[model samples]
Target: MQKVDILAIGAHPDDVELGCGGTIAKMIAAGKTVAIVDLTRGELGTRGTDLTRAEEAAKASEILKVSARENLEMKDGFLQNSEEYQLKIVKMIRKYQPTIVFSNAIDDRHPDHAKAHKLVSDACFLAGLPKIETVLDGQPQTAWRPKQIFSYIQWKNITPDFVVDISGFIDKKIEACLAYKTQFYDPGSKEPMTPIATKDFLESLTYRAQDLGRLSGVEFAEGFTTEKLLAFKNFDGIVL
Candidate 1:
């Protein structure tokens, strides 16, 4: 039972990369143990097969240097915030026992993204209840809850509650995103063009980070939203 410092959950294979890869890269560089848990295999994606997505996800995880990556095998386009689904997420939370969790955006163009947000957020709360028993590997799991849970921005420009300075790690984020070659911009590929496969979409990754950075007074940054209020112990804890 290896405990991780953070767990990032997404609706599909590349959602984590698209949403918060830079933040993950920055945290990993700071020696924090991070893991990724994708809710689906992305079998319904138009550009690539499940097998290709898995391969690409593995490559991206390698680039990000995540401690572990797991897919929950949930239905790709039909994500549900049901108890069964919530329990599955609770199991992972209990297993990892992460102090912080990053989930998909609360609202996005893709319906699955919002659904995943609710599922992960609800599970995070339910996981801490001792009455909600769960078992993994033939053993009973203990109740656990993360200290913080934040939602990353995606597709939509929902205002962020706070931003993380990822000045030096944006390149790593792009590199990891490009690892999903079958899903992103590629002029040579015969695959049908999707919104995410466009050249502008590829460029948006950098420009979006830059825009967030401009507002935050950093070279590059990533935005996140949280339901609970965030507090700092001292003035020095914040970047000016």
Candidate 2:
């Protein structure tokens, strides 16, 4: 059981990359252990098949150098924030025991993304409860909850609570996102095109990061939101 320092949970395969690929890359470069959990195979994505997306996601993970990656095999477009879903999330939270967990935004263009956000956030809190009892293998697992859970902005251009400076990590982020060749812009692909398939959409992703970075006086970055107002122990942790 390898432990992770940061764990990112997404509704689909490419979500994490779109939301915070640069941050993950930066964290990895800073010697932090990061992992990703995709709740669905993105079977419903218009651009690619589940198998293709899974392969693409794997390539993305490799590019990001995530410590571990897994899929919950949840139904795409029909996911519910039910107890069953929460338990499944709990199992992974217990298994990974990360200090921080990043999840989908509270609201997004994709309804599934919002649902996943609620499910993952609720599960993180529930996992800290002793009565909710989820054990791993033969061992009675200790209740483990991430110190903080934040939602990464996606698709909707949400106002982020904070943005991480990922100046040097932007290229790595784009590399990871482009690994989903079947989903992104690829003239070579004979597949159908969608909102995300155009070259301009890809360019928008880069520009979005650049825009966010500029707001914080950085070359590139990723944005995220927190449920609660941020409280730091000291000013030393803040960049500005």
Candidate 3:
């Protein structure tokens, strides 16, 4: 099993790219190993087939240079908080054994996003129970729980608990996001326009980061909310 420092889980393929790709890029650049898990292949999307989405996800993973990327193939619009779904995530948590998990937003415009947030949050807690019993690759997997779970902001202006200064990596994030050509704003394509495909949404990616940065004293940044209170080892990590 490939151990990583961080595991980012999303409801759909480009969710991570749109939400925390800059943060992921910055962390990986700092030598932190990171993996991505898409809960769904986004088969119900207005544009792009499942194959196309999978291909785009692969390209986005390459752009971010993540250690690994996997899809759970969950139902696109209907996410459940059932044990079966929880165990699937448990297997991944055990397989990667990451300390930090980045999950979907607590609340968002998309119903699936909120559902995913609770599902992943519960799985993280359940993964720590020894009796859960998970097996990977025909071998019994040990129980593992992440130290922290942070929910990335998406499709809403929810207040953030903290923000990561992703100034230098915003371009990398945008590149990864645009990798899903069928999903985002593409003027040349004749596909039907969705909320995200609008030109305004494309520009919002940058302006939103800049706005968050403006509030937090950075050139650009990504915001996340945590269920647990965050503690700092020292003030040295804080940017002035």
Candidate 4:
């Protein structure tokens, strides 16, 4: 099994790129192995078909340079926080053995986002339970849990517990996000327009990062929230 420093889980194909692409790119540039697990193929998206979204996701993953990217193939717009789904997530968690997990926002405009958040969070906890038996490829998998789980900011402006300074990686994030050409700001296409396809929404990606950076006194940044209190080893670890 391949171990990863971080695993980012999202409800849809582009959710991770929209939420924490810069962070992932920055981490990978820093020599951290990162993987992506998309819960759905975004079948319900107005503009793109599942096949196209899958292709776009692959392109985005390559742009981000993630170690691996997999889709759970869950039904879109109807995800549930149930054992069946939790077990699936647990399998990936055990397989990748990531130290840190990044999940969808706890609350968002899309119902799947919040559902995914709960599903991943519950799985992370249940994955640590030895009694919760799971098997992968006919082999008994050992229980494994991530050291930390954080939810990235999405659709809504929910307060973030902390933010990462992605000063030089914002461009990479935008590039990865644009890789999903069918989904965002495609004026030349005759496809139906969605909230994300709006030019303003596309611009907001950068402006939002700029806003977060302004508040945090950085050039650019990505924000996330954690249920557990964050600890620092020393005062120097914090950015003033």
Candidate 5:
């Protein structure tokens, strides 16, 4: 029943934060509504438990100012681009009726990330199909599809189709990311360490934004890839 201007779907708890937190912050700061759908609790992650991830996710969502956030509770690391999974995501897409949807990169080192990309992309397309009925809270849901689907970049160095300028939002993005207390570096925590979700990882998040910003001539930015080519309606967009 919640309305949102944009909906970002991720394969795991922190993927959205790592991938598009700055963009999301920019959107929210501009008064555009936003939401997040975490496909899984990241139970299979190397560092945190499901309960801990959920709590951290909540904190991050609050910092992001998203209108809504939900976890599909799907199996982590074992997702499949199947009809059943697609239907579940479709249901959410219709329920939220977001105007723009952001999903994971189509190809990634994480098999689950690729699967999530396919699932969300298919669901976004199918959400517009009038015949594919979806129900929510015992009532039939109306068909709706997002106008645009942007895939956020991940671990891979795939060339981005475009980048979002997050110059003023770098701090906000980091704040949201640190909400995942158990995932990132906490010098005081006794939890085991991992390659990602560490202090160095957190530092990289900032520098990554700086790197992308330099390429786009912005103070900070986030990169994204698109399934189809990007287009602008006017010649002004072509101006230097």
Candidate 6:
């Protein structure tokens, strides 16, 4: 099993990119190992096919410098918080044994986002239970739960419990997001224009980060809601 410092979960390919890519980039640059687990192939998206999304996800993973990226290939837009799905995520949680987990927003424009939030949260707890056994690749996996779980802000501007100052890594985050050429704003894309594919939405990415940064005293930032209250050992953890 490959252990990572952080594990990011998303309902679709670009969810993490749109939400917390800058935070992930910043963590990685600081020498923290990170991995991504996409819950679905995004087969039901209005813009692109599942295969293209997978390819784009790979590109984004590379750009973010994640240690590993996996897709559970779940049914898109119809995600359920069932034991079957929870166990699937539990396997990954046990496989990676990450100290921190980042998941989809609690509430979002997409129903799947909220569903994934609960699913991943449940799985995180279940993964810590030794009674809930999981087998991976002929090996018995041990129970492992992340110390902290956070949900990134997406589509909606739900006030974040905390904001990460990603001032310097914003460009890298945008670059990773644009790698999904068919998903985001593009003038030449003749396929179809969805809510996310519009020009305003792309611009919102920057403006939204800037707005949050303005409130938090930074050039750019990403917002997240924590499932558990955080306790800092000292004042050093606070951003000045």
Candidate 3 lDDT over 54-166, as tens digits, reads 99999999999999999999999999999889999999999999999999999999999999999999999999999889889999999899999999999999999999999
Model 4: residues with Cα > 4 Å off, grouped in runs: none
- Candidate 2 Cα RMSD after full superposition onto the native fold (Å): 1.2
The window of 10 residues in a row where model 1 has the poorest summed lDDT is 231-240
- Estimated TM-score per prediction? 0.99, 0.96, 0.99, 0.98, 0.95, 0.99
* Model 3 poorest ten-residue lDDT run: 230-239
Candidate 5 lDDT score relative to the true structure = 0.88
- Count the clashes in each prediction: 0, 0, 0, 0, 0, 0
Clashing residue pairs in candidate 6, if any? none
For residues 118-176, write the lDDT of model 6, one tens digit per residue. 99999999999999989999999999999999999999989999999999999999999
lDDT of 2 by residue, 163-238 (tens): 8988888899889999998989998889888988999999998899999888888887788999887787888845
* lDDT of model 1 at position 124: 99
Clashing pairs in 5: none
RMSD of 3: 0.5
Compared with the true structure, model 6 gives a TM-score of: 0.99
Candidate 4 local lDDT, 205-226, one digit each (tens)? 9999999999999989899999
The lDDT for every candidate, in the order shown, is 0.95, 0.91, 0.96, 0.94, 0.88, 0.95
Sequence-dependent TM-score of model 5: 0.95
Kindly provide the TM-score of model 4 when superposed on the true structure, using C-alpha atoms: 0.98
Best by lDDT: 3
Which whole-number lDDT from 0 to 100 does residue 4 have in model 4? 99
Regions of model 3 farther than 4 Å from truth: none
Off by over 4 Å in 5: 235-239
